[model samples]
Target: MKTPWAVVVGEVADVKENSPDLPLKQQYYIPDEQEAEMAGSLGSPTDIADNGGYIVLRTAMAPEQMENLLRSTVHSIDPQLPLTQVQSMEHAISDSEAPRRFNTALITSFASIAVLLAILGIYSVIAFSVALRVQEMAIRMALGSQRSGIFRLVVLSGAKLALFGCGIGLAGAVAASRLLRSFLFGVSPFDPLVLTLATISLLLLALVASLLPASRAASVDLTEALRSE
Candidate 1:
């Protein structure tokens, strides 16, 4: 049911291809000449391109040298022809990702700040608990419990809280990551590697935050702790 170019319209075969900048659905592929004819028929200028096209080149030589060679070759063929935006594949990909990189940096900064605040919060909670239990700790030490045991006990408490918090956070993250799918590339929103790394990082930070309070609890002066009660 087409009125354009006089060519046989054969049954279409599905082909799967991916482009980072373009959608994958409802795409057509035709010869350059045929596409030009169709564009002309649609009242568009076929003599000149509105947007420039790009060429992909593979070479064993260095990119800078290849770019120079390409420019010289193009000039030799047509002195009037001008090539703009000549760049290596790496540069092109990086340029395309410039905005994405900025977004990622912003997200990372916010996430870092949030993690810092969480660590501080954990430290505060553990420190307060240690202060309140000073008498109990003094009694335990008097009854032959070692300072190292007190340190271990305090650290284990923090770890248990961290584990519980991480479990809940992971659940929320799995739900929230769906919103981030648009910003991510080449990785799934539910990527196991990323989740594992985040969990491990948070747990380690929690342990670190608990360390100072644990140390203080272990070094508590028995007289001061007993008198404070």
Candidate 2:
């Protein structure tokens, strides 16, 4: 939709209402000569048109190399002119995105630490449970439980716990997706691909954590385990 500013603009070449940062406001662009003449009549004389304008150039060479040349060229035209915010396109983009990059890295670091702790916790719990069940395992082995059965028993138990945890987490994420909708960028809060990858990663880690204990249970010394009781 057009606003009262359309009078000054005459007609817009394009609109950028889709931009998240831009809001409905009075904004228009006009030629520098017409603007200067208008401003001169308003006692805000724009002499060399140094007050505003954007210089966009494309070059294969490094942007840094152009900075000095651009500044000197501008100064050569008018010695009193000052160049402000002279930065490369890459630098401008990086500067604008610096905060988001820092936040993502910080959150990722915490998530990694949380995953590592979960893996350690899983390993400890399964190992302790196996230790406590040594006598039961020994009796089972003596009563004709095969080594493969023992392995399956431990691994399957851990798998159940892992799957249960993932289910709970996925449910919680879905419930909170609305609350988190604004914070996510480039991806949806409930993006299925990301969620599936995360779930798979946790399950794999949990299975890895259980492997040592499962192997220990499967190859355990039946006589020692029974005699220790």
Candidate 3:
């Protein structure tokens, strides 16, 4: 195979035909004569080289019809020739991506559960704080504090904690992204838009979680809350 053959490299092709993660490497396209020479050295005929190769055909026919036609055509040349792994281009791409898709889905499910737990934790902490400060809230309203002020106080308190946690989470996420570089395609590990969106979503949910506690604080019965203390 190393023997020199008088052949010209007609063209050069560059493609990511397999996967984007695959490294760029050289692939030689030698002529039939060179192939035959290599095959002879390996104690095989030139036709062995042609035993496996792809045939792409574009047609208006349905896949089933096209497959039948392809089978008939190939068998016409040699009835014993077998056709295997017959599928459309879309199917081929999907098949190749199946594993990646599964991993993405599994990660997404776990991420969703983690976010839900975070929202619940925020809600519980804010609700507990509101419960403990019920008399303080009642006294403030009894004096001159507006109900709107109490509501804003509670909500803003939760929001501050949420924002702080979000900052730490963002830092952690940026660090963790590098681990997922191999699984990612067509995007950077540190995708700013995605990180921003995730942070915003968590913050919004935290605010929503704070709403119930804020409402209860604002609507406290001044006489009853003060008497209880």
Candidate 2 structure, TM-score to reference: 0.81
List residue ranges in candidate 1 displaced over 4 A. 1-22, 25-52
Candidate order by lDDT, decreasing, is: 3, 1, 2
- The list of candidate 2 runs beyond 4 A from truth reads 1-28, 36-53
For TM-score, the strongest prediction is 3
Q: RMSD per prediction, one decimal?
A: 4.3, 4.6, 2.8
Model 3 ranges off by over 4 Å: 1-13, 30-34, 37-50
Error of 2 at 3 (Å): 14
Q: Compared with the true structure, what per-residue lDDT tens digits does model 1 show for residues 1-229? A: 3456656567576544433634556656566677676656454563535456667799999988998999999999989888999888788778777887898899999989988998999999999999988888889999999999999999998998899989998888878887888887667878899889999999999999999999999999999888874
- Model 3 per-residue lDDT at 130: 98
* TM-score per candidate: 0.76, 0.81, 0.87
lDDT of 2 by residue, 1-229 (tens): 2221213536665454433334466557767666555554443433534656668788776767888788889999999977788877777767766776787798789889988988898899899999999888888999999999999999888888889989998998889888667556556978889899999999999999999999999898988998894
Q: Over the stretch 1-229, how does candidate 3's per-residue lDDT look in tens digits?
A: 5653455758687766666567778766665666666556545553554667677888888888999999999999999989998898889888878888999999999989998998899999999999999999999999999999999999999899899999998788777887878779888877889888988988899999999999999999998998994
Q: lDDT of all predictions, in order shown?
A: 0.85, 0.80, 0.86
Instruction: Score residue 12 of candidate 3 by CA lDDT.
Output: 82
TM-score of predicted structure 1: 0.76
Please say which candidate is ahead in TM-score: 1 or 2. 2
